[model samples]
Structure formats: structure tokens, C-alpha cells
Target: MRSLPLATAALTAAAVFVPSLPAYAAPAVQITKVYYDSPGKDLRSNTSLNGEYVTIYNATTRAIDLEGWTVKDKTGYTYTIEGVILGAKKKLTIRSGQGSDGTSTVYWGRRAYVWNNDEDVAYVRNARGKLIDSCGYDSTRYDYKNC
Candidate 1:
């Protein structure tokens, strides 16, 4: 009984002395959304394919240059980001089909689809190959996933 009381007192003292940890900070760049399944059938049309996309958002307060960044899927389908600077607190939508690059959108220019309908993972990496964020979906019920 004496040993149990001593241990309890020690634990209580330690708990009182320990400082609370800070909350976790959000990622600078995050894969916020993934439009995995395009509308209608998987006909692989430009419009249909354009519907499939991944939205990468910058969560930081400063603009992030994604010149050399890369966006990839589970099966290694990668889209190398070139000549782009994502604005602070803004979203960059990377579509699967071909399109002209814009301030908020870019094209992967792939003839075939990248995201798997049933299940897939989207990964975003920095210019130096550091992974910034990723989002995944395993269900076909929902066509999109808000990451």
C-alpha cells in the first residue's frame, strides 16, 4: 500500500510539471480534393477526362512556387509541375486531360486516365522530392474525395 501511494504521488507530480504540447501545424501544401471519377461513363474523352482532376491547395500565407513539383498517383502516373506559382491560400486544379496552363489550372496531357475508379492515392511532392501531402479514396460510391 505504501509503494502504490508513492507511485501515484510521483505520477501526479510529473503530470503537473509536464507542459502541454502545441497543436500540430497544417501542411504548407495539401492535396485538398481529388475528382477521381469523371461524370458519365469512362469514355476517356477530353471533356470527360478533364472532369477528373486533383486540387492542390496552398495552406500557407505566402505564394508557393511549384515549378518543379510533382503530382503522382498510386500506380506511378506522375505530372511534373512546371512554370507555376500557386498563390497563398489558393487552389491549383490539375486536370487529367490536355489544356492550356492557367493561373489556377494545369494539364497532365495524358491520353489515358490516371486515377483508378475503385481505389487510388494522390501524392504531392515538392521540387526537391519532399512529399507535401497525399489523399486517398477506396470507394466508388463517391466520385470525389475532399482531402
Candidate 2:
């Protein structure tokens, strides 16, 4: 009983002197995967080009409204995304060719290949042109083979 008040006061003083941790922001949308190389007999065909895609992921547990996002390749090919709601922990794949929008996939409607077989970089930006995420590739090296 004699030491209860002294212990409480000491703990309170230590807590007051200790610094609090900084607050961290939620994770933004990111390019989790990139399928730059299309595997088929005809690389230029609509079917083959449509197979090349990039996948964006929302890792958080809240819906994100991607109203005016843009995905651009290293060769200046830009795909503008319209009104789309990305659900929590969900992924959206944007193909290089034409197709109707689905629950987890969308189309870029490109006639030619947007990504190169040797090397390339894919960038994802928000409506304000701020980079959300990006992925790169290098086919020439043995260790860097994401092309």
C-alpha cells in the first residue's frame, strides 16, 4: 500500500518522457505483376497482344475509386482508365488489346505490342499524374529476367 502511489507516478513519468511512434499512411495502389512478353505463335495478332497485360493490386481493405488512372509503357503507349472501383485486396489486369470490361480485367485496345521483348518499364499513375507504382525488366541478363 505504501509503494502503490510511487510506482504509479514513476510509470506515468516514464510514459510522458517516451516519444510516440510516427503515424504511417495506408499503402497505395501498386503494380504487383507485369506480363510484358506474350507467348503465342503470332505475337502481332489480336489474341496475342491481348494476352500481354499488367496487373495492379489494392492491398488495403477498403474500396479505391480509380476514376482517372493511367498506365503508360516506356515506348509512350498510354492507357487511360475510366470510372472503376477497385475493391479491397483485389487485382485489376489491363490487357493490350480490345475487350469489354469485366470484374477483374480491362482492355487497352492497342493494335501493336506495347512492351518490348528485350527491356521495358511500366508505370502506373493517379489522376494527378503522381506515380503509384512501377515495374521494370531486363532480358539481356540472367538474373534480371522480368521481361
Top of the candidates by TM-score: 1
Q: Model 1, clash count?
A: 0
1-147 in candidate 2: lDDT tens per residue? 969999999999998897879997644788876787788765588889987899898988998988899999898799998878999999999999888998799999988888787788899999999988788987776324232
Error of 1 at 113 (Å): 0.7
Kindly report which residue stretches of model 2 are placed more than 4 angstroms away from their true locations once superposed: 1-27, 143-147
Worst 10 residues of 2 by lDDT: 138-147
Q: lDDT per residue, candidate 1, 1-147, as tens digits?
A: 799999999999998897889998879999999988889999989998899999999999999999999999999999999999989999999999999999999999988999988999999999999998999898756655788
Instruction: Single out the weakest 10-residue window by summed lDDT for candidate 1.
Output: 138-147
